[model samples]
Target: MSMADRIKTKLTERFHPLLLEVIDDSHRHHGHAGWQEGGETHFRVRIATRDFDGLSRVAQHRAVMSELDDELKERVHALNIEVIPADKA
Candidate 1:
């Protein structure tokens, strides 16, 4: 599966987010470090879920990063995350 698809699937399974948007920002970073010819190196993930309701920003980012550990280690170079609470979604 594509990196975006994998991110969506993992976040959906783990958080059951009310809203999730995985955007590939690689094209915007073209020619910069970590930018591959075919892209898929940079991403922005916006997710809203009750799971993140009580977590601090750092904790929320850690949780998301933990869920995507393999992808981060193997493929993804930069990951920007926005974790919103379900009520604020």
Candidate 2:
């Protein structure tokens, strides 16, 4: 499966988010550091889950990063995360 698909699956299994979007933003970083020839090196994840309700922004990011640790250690270079607020959800 693609990295995006894998990421989405992981988040779904962990958070059961109200909203989730795992976007492959690799193409936009072409020729930059860690930009591989085939892409899948960077991502933007937008998610909203009750699991993140009381966490600070940094904690929210840490939670998602922890879930995606394997991917980060492998090929993913960057992860831009947006943890949507309850009001937004």
Candidate 3:
């Protein structure tokens, strides 16, 4: 699967989001750190899930980072995440 798809899959399985968008933004960073010809190094994830409701923003981000730890270590160089509580979506 593509990195964005993998991220979407993992997030879906874990968060069961009301809204989710995993965007591959690697193309925007050409020639910058971690950029490559094929472009799977950077991403932006916008998600809304009940699971995030009570969490502070920092906690929410940390939770997502932890969930995608392997991807970060393996290939993904940067991830921009915007999390929303389902009710707020």
Candidate 4:
């Protein structure tokens, strides 16, 4: 599977998000640090989930980060996360 597909699948399985978008931002950051040739580096995630219903922004980010632990350490260079409650968006 592609990196974007893998990320979306993992987030869906883990959080059951109401909405999820995994953006491959590698091209935008070309020549920036950790810009790999394979385009699995920079990412921005917009996810709305009930799992984040009562969580603070930091807590929501932590939860998502934890779920993406392996990817964060290995393939991903940066993750810009937007965690929103399902009802808000």
Best by lDDT: 2
lDDT of 4 by residue, 43-86 (tens): 99999998787788999999989988988888899999987679
The segments of candidate 1 whose C-alpha lies over 4 angstroms from its true place after superposition are: none
- Which residue pairs show backbone clashes in model 1? none
- Clashes counted in candidate 3 amount to 0
Error of 4 at 8 (Å): 0.6
**RMSD, one per candidate, in order:** 0.7, 0.7, 0.9, 0.9
Model 3 residue 15 lDDT?
86
Cα lDDT for residue 81, candidate 4: 98
Candidate 3 per-residue lDDT, tens place, 1-89, comes to 88888999999999899999999999999999988789999999999999988899999999899999999998899999998668878
Candidate 4 residue-pair clash tally: 0
Instruction: Return the top candidate by TM-score.
Output: 2
Alpha-carbon lDDT, every model = 0.94, 0.95, 0.92, 0.89
- The backbone clash count of each candidate, in order, is 0, 0, 0, 0
lDDT of 2: 0.95
Task: After superposing candidate 2 on the true structure, give the runs of residues whose Cα lies further than 4 Å from its correct spot.
Answer: none
Q: Residue 54 of candidate 2: its Cα lDDT?
A: 89
> What shift in Å separates residue 60 of candidate 1 from its native position after superposition?
0.3
* TM-scores of the candidates in the order shown: 0.96, 0.97, 0.95, 0.94
